[model samples]
Target: MTSLLLYFLLGIISAIIGALPLGAVNLAVIRATTTQTILNAFYIILTAGVGEILLATLALYYNIELSHFFTQHPWVQGSFIFTFFFIGIYLLFIKNKINTKNYPKLHTSKLITGFSLATLNPPVAIYWILAISWIDKYIFELTPHTSFVSLLLFFFGIYLGKTTTLYCYGLWGHKIAQQKNSKTKLSRILGVALIILSIFQGIKFIAE
Candidate 1:
């Protein structure tokens, strides 16, 4: 039981730390919160959490198979490049109405938007594989041979930690959004950060 608890705690700590970085998932959560209500942003958080755990689970059990799949499919990688470049461009220059008076209703299901944001990146699986390997080496020894109950605990902890980290970001966004004068400024800052991040992703693809 103590061993199982360790697995779960490891999952929580790892996820919280992992989600702290500025990336697609947390950016989307921060965007949602800043644009709308904190509660609505949580709709994105819940589904995004689901998507993150799904990717982590696949990577944990099928690291080699997934690695081969990404290598074999050039189109999948191409899509990520296109997506990053497109989003970067859009955010950098696109002018849209910012209605700070009232939160706008999302046309799409917040859940679907969040899930797609989390799941579309194929390389995130690789991150999980690398992260798990590092954790296994220095933190604890986890393997494909790990017991099912422990894996379950770990996954659930991942879900919880991911959402919690995102919620913290949501709170930050809410605080910024609450500032009546900063909506446009926030958009510009987020746009620049996203563009930089996307460029970094492109550079990583080339380097790898």
Candidate 2:
């Protein structure tokens, strides 16, 4: 019983660590703002948390040296930056192709978006490696068997934190939408932010 409680605590901590940033998922939710946007973003963020949980679990159990791979083949980081850059370009230029009017109202697809954002981003992978290493040290001192369980708890916490953050964004969007402000201006601002961030990440990747 005490062991189970410990695992729960671990999950909470890891989730908080994993979900604190405004990355692609947050950008997507920001772009998709509507009456249903917050709920959709919540599910998206939840699935992303699940993906991180799985990755952390696999690395700890399999003894995968993710950091080593990342440091050695730094091009992998470039790929993620490229992906982000391409996404920003697409969002900025070809958004009309999405046919928002014909888009499905269902929330199930939100999970897919979340998973991709969490699993595919280079920073997310790096974050997990750092987070898992920290967790590994702490748990190995206690009991190796429980480390993975702790990561699972951390995953849940990440989703909880991310969902809460997105929910707040949704509320803000709703409030802002009620005003006469331009959504196009908001989107352009988001697009520029993504482009600049991606370029910075890409430059850092190449430098390392």
Candidate 3:
């Protein structure tokens, strides 16, 4: 149907938006190792794709109110802020503790990090809230019969696009990591950025 094509185009746009940022997950992958293993990176990316699709699906089923609740709740917001603070401190202050003398292996635990990084980040959630809300309200609102199908297709497109972005970033990060002898500087910068962002968000949440 004509309506379906419009929704599909919208879905593609949402996918591009979601995939634009190289967030913590890819950053970690980049910092961890410097190897060109596209196949392995693709595997990790597949997991990320599934996570993104799941989040988008949930966001569509819910809406802005749900995202606002999570962002506004004292306990939830405080916990996330605290977690970010600690992670930043550890990465910045205790770089020696990470045993960077040797490259770390990406394993099952790292996948958990990927999932948590995607799910817990407020910005990611907010982006999904906006994208999913717009897609639902503007594109799928009139097509009652095609609602679920449209959502599924949109989610699929988003997952693929985002995953592809990560894979590309992985390649770049891998190459960069190999050439860079100093991780401390980059780690410090990233850590400080995280700390500042968390503090700003925490204050805003409290004020709200």
- Highest-lDDT candidate: 1
Best first by TM-score, ranked: 1, 3, 2
Which of the predicted structures, 1 or 2, would earn the higher lDDT when compared with the native?
1
lDDT by residue (10-54, candidate 3, tens digit) is: 666786677665456666555545443545555556666777766
The sequence of per-residue lDDT tens digits that candidate 2 reaches over residues 67-162 is 677778887877778877887777666663567877676655777987877677768767766666776677733224656555455556555655
Each model's lDDT: 0.79, 0.64, 0.66
User: Per-candidate RMSD vs. true structure?
Assistant: 3.1, 4.4, 3.9
Q: Give the TM-score of candidate 2.
A: 0.70
Scored against the true structure, residue 24 in model 2 reaches a CA lDDT of: 75
Against the true structure, what is each candidate's TM-score?
Answer: 0.84, 0.70, 0.72
Of candidate 3, the 10-residue stretch with the lowest lDDT total is 31-40
User: What ordering of candidates by lDDT runs from best to worst?
Assistant: 1, 3, 2
Cα displacement (angstroms), candidate 3, residue 22, comes to 5.2
C-alpha lDDT of residue 14 in model 1? 74
Of 1 and 2, the candidate ranking higher by TM-score: 1
Candidate 3, superposed: residue stretches over 4 Å from native: 19-22, 32-40, 64-72, 96-117, 120-123, 138-145, 203-207
Which candidate model has the greater TM-score, 1 or 3?
A: 1
Instruction: Write one digit per residue (lDDT tens) for candidate 1, span 67-157.
Output: 7887788678767766766766666667445333577754888889889988876656667877887877787767778888988899888
